[model samples]
Target: MNPIAANKAELIAIADAVAREKSIDRMIVIEAMEEAIQRAARARYGAENDIRAKIDPRGGDLRLWRVLEVVEEPEDYFKQISLVDAKERESDVKLGDFIVDPLPPIEFGRIAAQAAKQVIVTKVRDAERERQYDEYKDRQGEIITGLVKRVEFGHIVVDLGRAEGVIRRDQQIPREVLRVGDRVRSLITLVRRENRGPQIFCSRAHPDFMKKLFAQEVPEIYDGVIEIKACARDPGSRAKIGVLSHDSSIDPVGACVGMRGSRVQAVVQELAGEKIDIIPWSPETATFVVNALQPAQVSKVVIDEEDTRIEVVVPDDQLSLAIGRRGQNVRLAGQLTGHQIDIMTEAAESEKRQKEFVERSELFEKELELDETLAQLLVAEGFTSLEEVAYVEADELASIEGLDEDVAAELQSRAVEALERRESGYRDARRALGVEDALSEIPGLTEEMLVRLGSKGIKTLDDLADLSTDELIGKGDKRREIPAGLLASFGISQDDGNAIIMAARQHWFADEVTDEATEA
Candidate 1:
């Protein structure tokens, strides 16, 4: 073969090799070469020329051109040509037509060759980075095994065959040492396209890492016979998984634990001996919470669904065990159950109940002019509020051991009078706070609610209307130091709060309609 043909074959061979090595399209590498050549030609000829370059993909035939526009009169001589002169190149040329003028091949100098090579390298690298990002972006939540490439600033850089992933310091299992060439498995938590390249962030400390490990060890999980519903981890210390089974015969916890603890042990080893608790998951929140706090006997569980909180009562001796070392057990249980758990001993729970009982009895005695014995009797029968006393069926009250119908009637009358007096006091306080009477006209605005709203500087209809339902009645964020809704203590539901705000804004709509009428 001649030297020119040899060089063309070599060019095609180089493009093939680059495409294979970079795992990019052969067309992309050829395009990069074209751009590099075009840049070099522009430097050789003139920077102001509209130069372009192209190479045949089948057999590397290089070509160069200077594009010029046909205009009535050429102002930019390098890029624009007169229509009369354009007719010499092409008889059919018209105004505004773009024509390409063929040019000779460029002989690259040493410096120009280096600059062209740099352009090609940069383009190929950018294409490779884009391919890496696209390949791994959807691979998040997957478990990948990789070799530890290096450690930088306590973060582990892993070689994942096609890409490099980073396990941040906080994402690694605590106290677990990793060295170069160590085989480690991690969950792909994030894949971000950054200026440098695609950032594949892996995590061994995430709860899903434990779940994925279980999925690997337990075939039942892999086949969808059992599913991991919830997981909580304390890094290298301990982890808990809540598993559920679709098939009735397959017990989720037992399947995850395996025969004689083989499956769970495999996962435990991978996690650096992080103890694993595979609990059977339940749809009932109480049942799930009870199972999550394992090894500790629980006497009772009181769940406040509105607050997403649980009060757990355990035996006095099991307090430390239920709470674990530094409250790790309860904390993991809370995370797994998705509830704020408060654990207490049986004695403490009893003391709380007694305290509430005394407070309610005293309220009845003071508000109803009742004797201590009668108030205690009312509390014992589950009548804890004045509203309950005033609104309860008269027959139910009369059935009490020491109360007749006449006594029940008198008790209800006194309860009503007491509630009215309390409401009057709240109204007086609300008025003193400069709250407008217009706020009282809105539905769901009670004297007590008005007083609370006044204290929060929501004394006018516009102020109340400006608030969202969540802001009016949401259980505020404790972490953010945001106070709870003004009517949250009153147990106002979300629907009620929305209705109240809409009612407050009714006047605004009325004013709009009135102005429209007056203009008409």
Candidate 2:
């Protein structure tokens, strides 16, 4: 009934109201009030004093204390007290003990009340931000519906019930107009904790956004009967999804498309009229690439797994359709299949094959002193390289039409001689480039590879060892104009490159072991 008792009751009521309005814990508000009181007490008492404040959550009874350490020597008079002096306050006080001194409650002045209010506001805001972050951090990749709060610099700010999310300009569906107060659904792509607060970034243009939409529309996807293996989107224009069915009876593409195209239509509408292609996913890379380039019939698919590239040969009439307008179709196919796709007409593919045939035949004729007819015959029988002829089973070569065992033996002898001459030439070229013989001793590095490395200024064993596997045999970034690796042209695998580098570094380990043994 007194003024102090009435103030305590009013404090408890305020804390409850703030906690409810902010949707934060009541204890957090009480703690914020305690901090505010502590700040005010510091202003009232000397700033040097170690003052702390506590408020009873149940009764709202405020308490203030000066915390001091008991020490043999009290250098900081406000924070430390001598053991003898501390005993005057507490009989059980010992050196290095932290003890609190109770202080009289002071009435709040106008300036102190304003400062306390600011502190409470700041603390409550910080608690609210932390709660929002914790609540939404795990909600990433989820589809969230919100009202369009505002637009700034082409970015959409959405009012998610408990938090605000931003749809960056690049994350919005192209040419899809959204106005204030309109309901919008987007995928929570990112949640970042920054100095300002937790940033919730939403996206309607991302491929995952379409996949989530499909999950909502298709019951099979939601229940895990069907899985979205891969997705690629061109924003408001078109999108492709590779779906796989766990249950064979339920076709993934059919389930996603739904009866009468209802499910896909729903997703298409949500994505601002984006056309959706629901392709059945395949485990085989070549089959998957062929499926990804839908609507355009593909005659053949040649996949280079090492480079993650696919070459599709289509009918000349379907060339424009296969490549799409402005190359969008092939680009989306590449994205969905995770491979770089090259589309060529059937005629072009045939022409390329003929050109390669002639080139191989000419190589055999020039290198092995073979007549044109025999060299052409060798190329036709799939003998593309000198090494293949030299190392292949003699019976296999003799089994070729019109080639007896004696002819097969003679051809292999010529191939071996030609390979040896090439190796000798490359060795001389490598030495001329100042490449160390130690480099050739590395397991995977041949004389030709050493010449390439030396031309690139990688002549020493240490220089070769210092290079990464990707640097040794990577298909370099074309966009960045980076040259491919020294052994890239030789079709060296990543494992081979790694083995070569390790072999080059073997001597380093040997020297280390020898030095340690010498020291011992």
RMSD of each: 3.6, 3.4
Q: Report the Cα lDDT for residue 326, model 2.
A: 93
- 340-384: candidate 1 lDDT, tens digit per residue: 899999999999999999999999999999999999999999998
- Highest lDDT among the candidates is held by which one? 1
Residue 119 miss distance in model 1 (angstroms): 2.0
Give me candidate 1's TM-score against the actual structure: 0.89
| Prediction 2 TM-score vs. true | 0.89
TM-score of each: 0.89, 0.89
- Please give the lDDT score at residue 207 for candidate 2: 83
CA deviation > 4 Å runs, candidate 1: 1-6, 96-98, 392-410, 453-488, 491-520
Q: Lowest lDDT 10-mer window, candidate 1? A: 475-484
- Runs off by more than 4 Å, candidate 2: 1-6, 67-101, 461-471, 475-484, 499-520
Candidate 2 residue-wise lDDT at 465: 78
